[model samples]
Target: MNSRKQVASSFTSATQIPISKEILETPVVTTIVSSSDEEEEMSFEADLWVSLTKTGKQKTPNMIRNDLQKYIDECKENGTSSQAKIVKSLAVDNDSFRKFMNPKNYPDQWSATKNETYWAATKLLEKVKHEKKSTKVATVSSARSKRKTSDSPCISQKKTKSELRSDLKALIARVHAVPNVAQNGGVYDSCTEVVAKIKKFLNRDGMTKALFLEAVLGGVNPHILAKFLAGKKQDQCETIVYRTAYVFFEKLRILEGRKKSKARNINEERYPQGFSLTKK
Candidate 1:
């Protein structure tokens, strides 16, 4: 038994790998950042820009006016407000905006500026915000109705600190278990696949969009993440994953507060009975 123990210990010691400077300085796999309900998930502003650009060509004054009109109509149809006021705010007046929109009516001095293009896009985004709010309210209402129908309370019972800690640890482990960024080429292969994956894992285990956003804002810069996610270059996708993962890991550390708690515990232990033992 002694010989066997010695042999096992020796073998373990012999196989132990030394930690490299690179390994210590940088992490490979990090905690996964997840978002809350798909409806509540915040899209990168860059993604919004891409969508806006794809809507139509904004080079001409007419095109910009047309897009603005479409958005205004959409907002009004969706129970927003008066389009005239909105248009007047964007340009000088509703008639003036229309005149600029018409190729024949367009004045020689009234050239479409970058500011006009931006304003039109901004109005479109405002419409989108209204739609998103409506969707969120509907989703919450539906969920509540379903719970009431099933005779179950909509609110869940509170969990104990230990239970919360255990759950968090399990979630962290699950995050680590996901395939590495380098694997599967990092970027999503297809729209369908990405959507399905998000549905399956995004809000799972108390991982909410709020938490994801906090991590994004707290660690990896949100603007950088947005740029990478919105970019056309395929190579940038991996970078997004790495930055997101690193930030997520940092967020987990913050949420767990393990170090702070551990230190407190140590202090309590050393100062038991409210007395600190001083060296003689």
Candidate 2:
């Protein structure tokens, strides 16, 4: 009997366990629910607070929240964000202003101006104006100084006649001393004597020695005698003295070649015939 009783108790316990498992796995329709209870609780709390505030004559948090949102939307529509407005207002054609607009390139606190955009434009314009003015002033001053130097009388003054005559005599003496001239059968000596005689003759003709030397040196070719007369008639005695020296040197070279036993190739062909005594 006791064994039957124990068997019956075991069967009852096993059946009860399975029934409890089925009930947990497949809940009853009345026991199951959607998960919106927390949301509904929050909404009820918000409504209750709004009603209490209205009765107490206090502003509702939702009203304040909506107003603040409306204000933000209006500001965005009007392009009124501080940084955005500044960038727009400071819009300029200048490269510097463009660089300044780049946050990574520009300093955070550039100046005390409340509007950074307008400040940059004004500052750059002023700087460019000042630079142009400075450049103009510098150019004008440089031109004025250059003109002054060019027009100065001292810069254009020529050597005096006496100084020129002295220089010519010295040059002739140097030419005579050259070894080539000495070997040319005293041809250079004759040239020097001719020049001296011409100077004397001109002096006798009431021409100052300085004026005579100047005309000769200025391309008269005193050695030709005819050119010398022409130069004197033309009042170009300085040119005569100058051109005569060239002819004298050329003749000296020819004479030197004749004196050389081997007939030295002096290459006088390189010199233009009459050009040797012509003015530059």
Candidate 3:
């Protein structure tokens, strides 16, 4: 036994012997690292000119009218007959005048020539207003033609409390069916087929309000999942689904928080070496 122990110790020492520094040292090899050098050439040139041409067109009636009117008014004050010449030159004919007055026909002029045209048209409209004011006219009261509350029999109609309660109960029952259908991802498909069948049933019944409500609430139509779910009572269904989904989401959030807390506690207790959670 002592001899066997001696042989084992010798084997262990031989295997565990440290490597020499010379054997561990790696040879240095000269390696040429090559990279291409590139340069971007850039050039810029600018040219400019000045001229006496007008920057924008003077096409607006308001602008033309204002300038024309100002010139005419100045001529009038100076006791010159140039007003008649300007009017003759600028005044559109009755046919063209009507078209020009239309905003659609003269969009640019309408917008840009507002101030100028307003003054010009004001003068013209004053003449028209004066003419109209001079003429006598009869007036009629529109209130006499309006219908009174007493004329309509249905205006005072009210729904009964029993009717409202019945509607609510029916809607609740319909909502309960949604969860069963929605379970196992079959709700959308079931609702679609149901809606289509319901539509056909309603159409056969001549599209009455009762039929519409029944079809929508019962999910008795044959349509796409989106369309099937989109019922008259969809708002109510959405409310229920939203509440349920929100509850689920809240529970999930709480579970996640708990898991994180537990993980953090475990990490704090262990503090294992070389087991860092922080990214390098």
Better of 2 and 3 by TM-score: 2
Query: What TM-score does structure 3 among the candidates reach?
Result: 0.16
Q: For model 3, how does the per-residue alpha-carbon lDDT over 1-280 read when each residue is reduced to its tens digit?
A: 2322342234334334475533222111121111110110000000000001142221234444444456557768878656455444434344543443455654333332222333234334333333454342211222332343347656655457566556645643454444322222212111222333333334431344343444333433333333434543223233223233223222333443433222223323444331221222
Write down the TM-score of every candidate. Answer: 0.31, 0.19, 0.16
Alpha-carbon error at 116 in model 1, in Å? 8.5
* TM-score of candidate 1 to 2 decimals: 0.31
lDDT per residue for candidate 2 within 115-162, as digits (tens), equals: 233233332233344456667997999899778778885665456777
Model 2's alpha-carbon lDDT is 0.37
The whole-model C-alpha lDDT of candidate 1 against the native structure comes to 0.42
For model 1, the stretches where C-alpha displacement exceeds 4 angstroms are 1-130, 133-150, 153-169, 183-242, 245-280
Task: Put the candidates in lDDT order, highest first.
Answer: 1, 2, 3
In candidate 3, which residue ranges exceed 4 Å CA deviation?
A: 1-53, 56-59, 90-280
